[model samples]
Target: MPSSAAWLMALLLNLMLAISTVFIGSCLSESPSKVRLVGGAHRCEGRVEVERNGQWGTVCDDGWDLNDVAVVCRELSCGAAIKARSGSSYKPPAPQEQKVLIRDFNCRGMEDTLSQCEQDGHVYNCPHTKDAGAQCEKSPSKVQLVGGAHRCEGRVEVERNGQWGTVCDDGWDLNDVAVVCRELSCGAAIKARSGTSYKPPAPEEQKVLIRDFNCKGMEDTLSQCEQDGHVYNCQHTEDAGAQCENPDIDSPFIPENVRLVDGPGRCQGRVEVLHQLEWSSVCKAGWNLQASKVACRQLGCGRALLTHACCNKTTQGKGPIWASQMSCAGQEANLRDCPFRSLEKNCTHDEDAWVECEDPFELKLVGGDNPCSGRLEVLHQGTWGSVCDDGWGEKEDQVVCKQLGCGKPLVPSSKARKSYGPGAGRVWLDDVVCSGEEQSLESCRHRFWGYHDCTHKEDVAVICSESIPRL
Candidate 1:
């Protein structure tokens, strides 16, 4: 019904709209390349990694001066450059992709980006040992750890401009604690200590730095997390504090330990062990029921399940297999006790063996063979876990003794906390407060099941009047 000229004009307008829409869409979808510090304990310290072309590769630290590092720190939203380090502080991975992405980045401590700074080239001829490392500090704001048993765990403190202040626990949780841990290069946020539960507070100038911190838990540093960053109505007593857990070792995988992981239930999953100071999977080659039997006993499980629905070959982990060519006669008390050969070649993590065993001790003692004379372990929700000594008392020990039918408790001993070995699997319970009148150990005030504020070293132990044999 319209004229040709009118229709022509309408079509041109529609074409223009489509073109503009596409231009805006492309702009919105474009993701800027990012740089992150990796392999260090904190977000502000580590080997430099740039995310470009959808792959993360390392940068050569050969010409890594503090001036260049300042640009990187400021670009990543961390505050100031502290030190530009060379040489890997950690052991290099046995197998690495080792892509050299950036090199010879020269900055004058004022540039906004490495790309903006002068560089010799995008790709450099350098060894991985020359990989750049850096440590950044948030200027005007600083974080420190104190009052903990170790350097890693502690009451968190911060400094702003020239005045020092404490953070409040208004919206504190593990996620917020995680940001602090990452900021400090501590392992992970174990627990948020509240109400002065750790120890007497240190005497200092009373000032609150930041409050109402809202962290998504994935932030690299606390500076990147959302917070009041300004005002609050909290007293110094209500000031927040954090306890972080450092990794047992400075590696991606834990070594010197053998444990089950990623299973739906306990004592089942991919079999992994530490060999040559690196944790790796056990190859399925030469694996059999006899081999599985040794694994079950080594982990304190009763027997191996043969059903595919419950047990099957497991090949889930990253990296190559560690051990192979196993031959077990089914009577071995420990997997390490069984005959096995180490293999460096011809094995992959996908070929790792898997097994599930019958449930272990519903309730038992560990770190000693005696029935009533070791660390307390409870079987709950298909896993064996340990309790903490935070608020443990004689009343709580009495219930444990009564539940085990191990006779009346005699002088609930804290010494056993050291005499008995630390637990291996998980620190499962904490802040247990029991009344002597309770019928069982479960009837006590404590953190939620699987919620704890301790490491294995702080596991609680008990000693009863006499040892009781299992029924």
Candidate 2:
């Protein structure tokens, strides 16, 4: 009804409005939201944080479960969700600084993004300590034991970023080995071996992923164990290995070829090896404390206490002395793992290698005129501390004297106090009640370690006879 120019203008205005509406709709579909894992051991693990309106915030753990984490893992391109951790276990680092954006995500696990899930975005007072977290099976974190006679025994290796590497043997012990065995479904670890003892060492090009591990021996996997992933200072030869119980075999593997002889006990004696059905003594050439440590560990004894000095006092073996020189770094799990070289034929049985592995009793006489008499102290958790004398008597004195290789008690505990002064640090044991027949002080009844009613002034003292034998 209007003029042609007016009609054209009206049509153009309508077209412009429609185009603007479409453009706005497309922009809304392509959101700029982002999600990430924060403060994890690796990129694929940690507290879940989301970005909204250019502000980063954490997701609340309310109703968080594996289903919610699976959606998150897939959205982040992580493989699969292995764990849905909440509370303090996966608490965000500096959580107070981050806002709580998302709450109660009801993820059906089919949603491509967390934003698509049914979530309560309106948060009230969700605690940051209740932040949601996820551990994903990110395809790169894996572990394996290799190069053993079977699947259970071998060198330890871990995978990271799509490459396999070894673990260093520094401080590698039974606890760490037990974790590996449990992870691989191998039974309890028989020994935590080092060097190329089980098989040839890893290739020189293989990097060491774990420098050191401190597992409490109860972790489901190696990732749960505490480890130093950075700063590797080990060679291929120092690769850690393990010997675990193989169910396929009739019996568990143990170091049976080696034994101790002609000494007070199985743990302390002359080092002998059974070869070709004949037992022979190890020669003194190149014998040292380091080699003795491996021998003691192999025999299921504790650490080596006295090696060279013990040989002179122990009875001599009456057999051929092996013409081999022991060169051990003191970290090998088995004595046979140490390097050996041919020695001269001049060595005799009297000069055989003798070792005394530390017994259960780590008692020592301190501030005394002689090794057999002084204020009594015991080693507990690597700290030397005094023992309370609430129930100290002659029976307690006799046990301490015999345990120390001191023939007998010389003076009564009551009369013995004046000569020795009070001890200094923690009162380790109290209400002592030894039965004289017990071999060591620890074998006797006492209060729980570090539980006592007496002070250091009540520290017990002992005086044994001067006929102290080698301990």
In model 2, the runs with Cα more than 4 Å from the true position are 1-269, 273-290, 296-328, 332-374, 378-384, 388-396, 402-422, 426-458, 463-471
List the candidate 1 regions with Cα displacement exceeding 4 Å.
Answer: 1-32, 75-80, 94-96, 111-116, 122-124, 137-471
Kindly report which residue pairs in candidate 2 clash with one another. Answer: none
State model 2's lDDT.
0.73
Measured against the true structure, the TM-scores of the candidates, in listed sequence, are 0.37, 0.29
Question: Backbone clashes in each candidate structure, one number apiece?
Answer: 3, 0
Compared with the true structure, what per-residue lDDT tens digits does model 1 show for residues 341-457? 544457655566777787654666676556887898887667888887876778778888787778766656577787886888876677665656665665554554676657888
How far does residue 136 in candidate 1 sit from its true spot (Å)?
A: 4.0
lDDT of each: 0.67, 0.73
User: How far off is residue 370 in model 2, in Å?
Assistant: 9.4
Candidate 2 has what TM-score?
0.29
- In candidate 2, position 60 carries an lDDT of 85
Candidate 1 lands at a TM-score of: 0.37
